[model samples]
Target: MKAISYSRYGGPEVLEFGERPDPKVGPDKVLVQVRAAAVNPVDWKAQAGYLDTIFDTVFPVIPGWDVSGVIVQPGVSVTEFSVGDEVMGYVREDVLCHGTFAEYVAAPVRTLARKPRNLGFEESAALPLAGLTAYQALHRALHLRSGDTLLVHAASGAVGSMAVQIARHLGARVIGASRDEGQDRVRELGAEPVPYGDGFTARVRELAPRGVDAALDTVGGQVLKDSAALLAPDGRLASIADGEVIALGGRYYWVRPDTDDLTALAGLVEGGALTVRVAASFPLERAADAQRANMEGGLHGKVVVTVDHDH
Candidate 1:
């Protein structure tokens, strides 16, 4: 099968497209005929080798984590899924576990969930990573509830966009922060948009004279520092950016995928409680271009890589 990979981590130039041996499935694993896969920040983190400490290093790695496809075959021990079943998953591709940059990739049954019936392969592909991060950080790590006010930093980006929508669904009054241009776009997603700039915190405090009930910090530099002070005494905070910021006194969040989280997200999409937006799409051979767009980071929504299969 033809796929894109990088023997070394650097810029998009490191990505090379070529044929690789088709992955064989292990007992408990399902071979998914990958219809589409979406790019996340982590994809470039691996491509650029920035996660040396957050994760173990491996060479010639394939970095995609969010995948949507049809089950072509399931292992002998896999009873949860069968051929022709449509699924999307937050797959944890262990280093060296070739990712969804190809025509097909093998995934453990535990990582699979029935794809949202309301979505297409492209939209389904966009959900697993960014959506889960938003759901977990808001409802799980941050302890949000209805009527509480919430602030989401970088709210126009992938994870941030999802965070704003998920927070609203959970009954929180969400304020989304992004650059001046992104404010309008995020505001359309049921959030009060704030500009992320000098004195951004002051702008946010003005939104909620009392204080925000919770915050999901997707852009965690000074943004998180201010979140600590903006929280309503019991207000919670969560971040996808990995770092020990205990000095700030807010909860630190690192996304962990589970079958239950995937199921809940699936339900939300089906029920029209959550929405997936696709900013661009590229064929598998153009995986390099897709990664380039994600790396540059100016697109309005998720960047997806479409793999070919007879769906």
Candidate 2:
């Protein structure tokens, strides 16, 4: 099968499009014909060796985790899904090879969920990782509840956008912080927009004088610090981007592949409580370009790589 891979850790320049061996299906896995895969910053960061200490890298690694595809074959022990099932997953394995940026992937059942019936493959592909991250952070780590006031940093980006919508669905009053250009989008996502940069904390304070009831930080460094300060006393805080959040009395979260969580996100999508915005897409062969596009930042939604089986 043709796939995008890199034999060594490097930038987009190291990625190559070529034929690679098809994955072997395990008893708890299914072989999926790839329809679309979403690019996350972690994809390129893992390719660049930033996560080497945390995840073992197999040489010539395929570099994607979020997928929306159809099941071509289910493993011998699989019973949850069968051939022809359309699914989406955050297909991160314990290791760093055999990823979704290929014609096919052998995805474990734990990572799979039925795709939202209301969305296309590209939008479904965009939902898993970012959606899971936001869902886990807001629902699990922060324990956000109705009537609570929540502040989401980077509120117009992929995960942050999901956070805003999910928080609103949970009946929270959302205050979203973004750049000036993304403020309108943040507001559209049901958050009161607060611009970042100078006076960011002050701006948030003006909206919630007692500080917010909870704060989610998608941007690290100074932004994380500001988020901590903006939290109301006894407020919950979580950060997917910075471990330093722990030092400031917040949980540092890493998204996990959980079928239950993905299913919940699909529920939100089908119910019209959640929507995915796809900012850009590239063919599978141009996955390196997709990675570069995601790395360039300033995108309000996901950058996706679509697979064409017709060719």
Clash tally, candidates in order: 0, 0
Candidate 2, residues 38-129, lDDT tens digits: the string is 99999999999999998988888999999999999999999999999999999999999889999999999999999999999999999999
Which 10 consecutive residues of model 2 have the lowest summed lDDT?
195-204
Q: What range of 10 consecutive residues in model 1 has the weakest lDDT sum? A: 242-251
Global CA lDDT of candidate 2, please?
0.95
Model 2 RMSD in angstroms: 0.7
Measured by C-alpha RMSD in angstroms, how accurate is candidate 1? Answer: 1.7
Q: Which candidate leads the pack in TM-score? A: 2
lDDT (C-alpha, whole model) for all candidates: 0.83, 0.95
Candidate 1, residues 1-311: lDDT per residue as tens digits?
77777888688888888878887999988999899999887888767767776576566676688899999989889989989999998777545447778888889887779999999999999999888888888777888888889888888989999888888888889899899889898989999998876887788888987888888877777777788788887777777773545556667777776778888999998888889999999998888889888878888889999987543
* TM-score of each model, paired residue for residue: 0.95, 0.99
